[model samples]
Target chain A: MKFLAEINVMPQKEILDPQGKAVKIGLQNLGINQVSDARIGKHIQLQLEAGSEAEANQIVTDACKKLLANIIMEEFEFKLIQL
Target chain B: MKFLAEINVMPQKEILDPQGKAVKIGLQNLGINQVSDARIGKHIQLQLEAGSEAEANQIVTDACKKLLANIIMEEFEFKLIQL
Candidate 1:
């Protein structure tokens, strides 16, 4: 089976997201003052082969935990769709 | 009313994403051979105030077009939710 995974890795609440803060300021400068807060993260799309749905889930989870996300400062979640 | 926007900015299909390529290689080195392709992009979460849903959409769209995304090399989309 073939699968597609859409993964998101976001900084933990306690961590400071300087890039996001910069973006917020930039938006404000552009006169979009309605914005109050902003956070930036990574969005990853993966195409893979797997034998079963469970196997696919395991692969994506392992990928995120082992390499895609820095669990110490970030958290990750993913949605897998069979193709 | 306050709204939250989830935005994604992705490299155009013709663009080469070096970071994504590096990640794919890293995954391969880690013995995750199932993955065939990977692409990386940005995920932004914004908290803002707006008068209506349409107004919120306009704000998010303007933000993406003006600052959050580089329209020439990237494409962006966002979902707005009432808060």
Candidate 2:
């Protein structure tokens, strides 16, 4: 089976997202001032070959923990959908 | 009402994502070879003040169309959750 993992990797709440802040400021400058607390992170989409749903989830978990996300500064979560 | 908008900005499929390609190569170098078509994008989380869910959605849609995404090279989608 082929599983698609859509992952969201975000900066820890305690971590400062300079790029996010910059974008927020950019937005404010553009006169769209209603949005705040803008936080930026990464969205990763990957396809994997797995025998079962559990295996696909496990592979994604490992990929997130070991490669896709930087745990020291960022946190991650994902949704799996078969494609 | 306070609402949270979770947005994903991704490179258009026809566009080349060098950073994403680099990350995929990095993964293979780390011995994770089961993954393919690795793509990278931005995850944006923001809080907004809106009178209703529909209003909030409009605000987010405008944000995505105007500032958060580059339509020529990237595409964006979002979900709004009340908080």
TM-score of each: 0.97, 0.94
Residue B2 error for model 2, in Å? 0.7
lDDT, candidate 2, B37-82, per-residue tens: 7899999998988899998898888888889999999999999989
- Calculate DockQ per candidate and list them: 0.92, 0.80
Model 2 Cα shift for residue A67 (angstroms): 1.7
Q: Model 1 lDDT vs. the true structure?
A: 0.94
Task: Compute the lDDT for candidate 2.
Answer: 0.89
- The TM-score each candidate achieves on chain A is 0.96, 0.96
In model 1, residue pairs whose N, Cα or C atoms come closer than 3 Å (at least 3 residues apart or on different chains), thus clashing, are none
**What DockQ class does candidate 2 belong to?**
high
Candidate 2's C-alpha runs over 4 A off are: none
Q: Is the docking of candidate 1 incorrect, acceptable, medium or high quality?
A: high
Best by TM-score: 1
Candidate 2 residue B15 Cα shift, in angstroms, is 1.2
